[model samples]
Target: MPKSKVRKKTVYTPPSSDRTTTPVKLAGPTHPVYIAVMLGMMLIGLAWLVVNYLAGNSIPFMATLGPWNFLIGFSLIVIGLLMTMRWR
Candidate 1:
């Protein structure tokens, strides 16, 4: 009769002693024009809400013409200004 040998498995783990931390810094110009445009659009939206409330005209067309148009126009104007400035 032959005797059988049993083998044991070993688990490996990485050392956690070596660690590095780096601080992240964001880079970009804080454009005042963009802020102004956003504020203007918000004001326009507020005005539209006020006008709708006062007039009692619950027309869907006003939604498209009032705040929506202001947002689109404001966005376009801001983008155009940014492009002209060439801020990269």
Candidate 2:
């Protein structure tokens, strides 16, 4: 009887040059309190408009100013949103 020969398989190794050393960083604002305060101010302004409307009372100087408060409130909200997207 003849003896059979065995064969071994070759293993694969990754190169060290393909590895990454730096960590990934996120992009955005880090101050939550400022954003919260801006949002709160906007909400308060909106609430004032609603309350005055329901009470059938004309907002002070609204007739002359022409929706100034609403515009200011909306601007505040937009600023808050922008600040939230900024990096700290």
Candidate 3:
């Protein structure tokens, strides 16, 4: 087998410090209603799963949904978690 040739690495160049940048505006705190909705989604998802497990067969609509109930429940939770990324 032939040995591979070694290549020289390029030198790192520092950026020029002469560029002026505008100050970034800081975002205000998230609204109380937004927090409430985010928390509500997660709580609702948990409640949905609990209800599905506890009485899935008893509820007419829940019985019809069958396995889809799991999807709906998990989706709500994931959406709520995603919303938290923008909360600040």
Backbone clashes in model 2, listed as residue pairs: 29-86
lDDT of 2 by residue, 1-88 (tens): 9989888978887666966779878666657787577667667667755654564246556555555756765676666566655536
What are the lDDT figures for the candidates, one per model?
0.61, 0.63, 0.97
Q: Write the per-residue lDDT of candidate 1 for residues 1-88, one digit (tens) a residue.
A: 9989988887888788677878888668748886666556555656655565565246767655765655555565555555545443
lDDT of 3 by residue, 17-78 (tens): 99998999999999999999999999999999999999999999999999999999999999
lDDT of 1 at 31: 86
Q: After superposition, how far is residue 61 of candidate 3 from its true place, in Å?
A: 0.2
Can you tell me which runs of candidate 1 are displaced by over 4 Å? 1-17, 27-29, 56-88
Which residue pairs does candidate 1 place in steric collision?
Answer: none
Candidate 2 deviant stretches above 4 angstroms: 1-11, 18-20, 23-32, 51-57, 84-88
Instruction: List the candidates ranked by TM-score, beginning with the highest.
Output: 3, 2, 1
* Poorly placed runs, candidate 3 (over 4 Å): 1-17
- Predict model 1's lDDT versus the native: 0.61
Residue 28 displacement in candidate 2 (angstroms): 12
Better of 1 and 2 by lDDT: 2
- Poorest 10 consecutive residues of model 1 by lDDT? 79-88
